[model samples]
Target: MREIKVQLYRGEDDNYVELWKTVEKIEGKHRYYGRYTYGNEGTWYSVCDPLGYCELNAPMADDVMFICCDENGNEAIRYSNADGNKLPKFETVIKREWNKAKEKLQHNTEDLTKNFWAECWNGDTTMKINQWLLSYKDPDLYPEKANDYDENWTGCWAEKEIGYEPIPDTEFEYLGHKYQFTKVKHKHEYCGIEWYEFVCTDSPYVMRDTPWVNDRAWIQSYMYLGNWFDDKTYGTMYDQRSAREKVVAALIKKFPMKNKWDKLLYVKKKTGNEFYNCDCCYEKSYSDMADVLINRNYHRKDVDYLCKFINKETEGIVFASNRGNKYTIRQTYPDIYDYDNCLI
Candidate 1:
């Protein structure tokens, strides 16, 4: 079991910030069921049966903190203590936190136009290669291995593909920086020939931040820490417009009309639904057109991440229909059992 987490603030009554916040729709008359704690009450030691009855006879749940409403519903929980420590409505906290997540999700997409190249392999991403060479050789792991062919110590050491022949190591002075070159190959053949290819070592930021993609690259790969020995996902990074963006971009392209009247409202999905809306929810009415972002394409494993699909634009362009971000809304909700393209 994971350790129970508690958050203590100096001024306010201590709150169980780690508690799982849930939502309960209130009907005519409702019963309450769950475990809870009062002011300075350490944790959820008090249990209440259904029908809003706090018998206070149940034992303390030392392991976890929860407030679950049963199938019958009516699990309204209002916890307080002698010292006046009180928790707001269960879903209230849930909404507050959810809003922060929603805001981050909606705005997380960066301008994919920048070419993240390494002027020098000195930063966190690039120095790693320097460190690797330092371990094997005293001063520098020159492209000596890069110039020759040997499985043990070479730039593309781990790639044992039969056909690939290591080209001689070449370097030149460019703006007072040395850029090393190893065997470069096309990721995949295009139109029966290799057309577009970019170079970055096993890991991004090794020599330069590699091009997994900048809106055009597919789900390409890089080694873990630029080291071939480490286990890694095939694609370290990738890029393409989102399913919704693809839809909108395509609509603007296909049905091109000059004026406002000709502008087709192709999108059917707009934000503002209960599963994501916590405020309009529980309340009598909901916010009109709640523009909360539903997902942030992030690589959950490392900080450099994307929660979006690994499919290239050509592959995911089908979503360029009425998907309108709403498609991701359905697939990327936090609690979904099987989230499509969920990097988990």
Candidate 2:
């Protein structure tokens, strides 16, 4: 027999009251069923029914006091809100009771590993290695073994099958900053060939400030093992270059220089002359060609000369000579000609 503390409250009262009850083990299960109520004055009292007995399947009232406990009344499982307090949270108490009923009889790692692999594949190598290592030791006695086993089990497994060899640490500069090589992983892709994956320790400032680049961007800049050898001559040349040189070349190729004039040309071709004109003139134009050209950063002497040159080179290019309005060119013919058609 063991005593367990439970909290219960009356329907009309907001305060919870604590109760202690003794439970007896019968046929490997705790059994206790009794109904006790306080009098109208709400005074506490005790009732003992020595001959009364009930099965575990009996319906319990909403305010019944119960806690999850083993046969000896020791707390078998920790509840999220138990906190060793008299009044445990309502939801935590319910969860504790539910878990006590649905507890697993044994731990099965095979099923758990299969489920984990099915969901995420072997991408989570850390979890797979930890689970595999735990199977070799008694978790209860050697609880700290999992924390101490920090070997790269995945790399060891790959090395056995692929004959993969790790490269020593190397330092290189990228984008005006230095980075240090950390580790490598090689996987067998063909009968006699293996592909390598490199990991580098990137600077914190570079990782945070760079807009589109991440830590893995350095490795991805280089071609994959299979593709690296596709160009026979270039591959031979690449093999000859030092590691630092190869990394520098990959980084340079990844972010190629852009020609400012070429970018301007591309914008002009895509958006047409209106965009170029507006861009160069700051979107400000007059009604006359002379005034428009003058406002567009052309000198006073060169404005007339350029206007005349443009009028000869383009069709329907004529200057409006109206004094009431600003002088500008009419590139298209209107139904009525309201301005003097000056050749320039």
Candidate 3:
């Protein structure tokens, strides 16, 4: 008997993995079942059978080619059946599914409005008048270093007054006197759904014009990805005395924001590894526009659906340099571009 395990992004589905009994039809295909790890990270799996043959269909973009391993975790066999067995062709099927899923993932009425607010608010701090704090750390330090304001308040104010310069108290001392070392600055922007025009509903005369509520119904300011908006202003300042230092920094800065905790009170999904800090303004100000770009589905078709929805709604605002949620199908899956087994 030939045993096979089918998986969707490494999922345990019998339909995807076809198995054929030794006495059963060998010319036709069969389905098998198994599982890989969960979450956005990568995963691996193995399968061992008394019988030696198992063939697989073409894998999707995110699907990694399986490698059968021995008990000691060494590579054993290629993830295919006999030498004569062949994989399925996915060019036509993948393209068809891609188009269909893309259309299906289009945001609903609520989603359209909510996603718009999230994108707008994530750009600048329009939630609270003109006050814009890069990240929560900036606002938290505001109260502590408020008394240390020594520069002339008349001018635009030095970087110190605006919470950009390093505070003496928060510094680490090294040589003679007080040495102020490097501090990680988490940069971000904030705004809200009200800034846009389409979200409004009621008549201009009767409805109240408040920043929080508009005709289009705003989506609250919920935190998205971390360091997605970092401006790289945390580097050494030439003017400061102790500006130079050899240090390692995470390409993606990680700063804990306050609003994230408050938002959790309203939305119960803020627990565990899912909680990402908000970048709106400086402090923790919960607005009515929040959402994430990540699609928590295992299927490549499903992921493509969510990406298409984003592409349509954002109107090209979704890029690493441009505004809104930044993402790439390539980053998540390299196999999607392969011609023979592509899943795009």
Best by lDDT: 2
* Candidate 3 minimal-lDDT segment of 10 residues: 243-252
lDDT of 1 at 293: 16
- Point out where model 3 deviates above 4 Å: 1-5, 9-136, 139-141, 144-344
TM-scores of all models?
Answer: 0.17, 0.14, 0.16
Candidate 1 lDDT tens digits, 145-192: 322321132223222221222223323221122332223333221111
- For every model shown, the clashing-pair count is 12, 6, 24
The residue-by-residue lDDT of candidate 2 on 237-304, one tens digit each, is 11101222323233223323243121000001123445233211111112222233333322223433
Clashes of 3: 24
Candidate 2 positional error at 240, Å = 34
In what order do the candidates fall by lDDT, top score first? 2, 1, 3
TM-score ranking, high to low: 1, 3, 2
What are the Cα lDDT values of the candidates?
0.27, 0.29, 0.25
Worst 10 residues of 2 by lDDT: 260-269
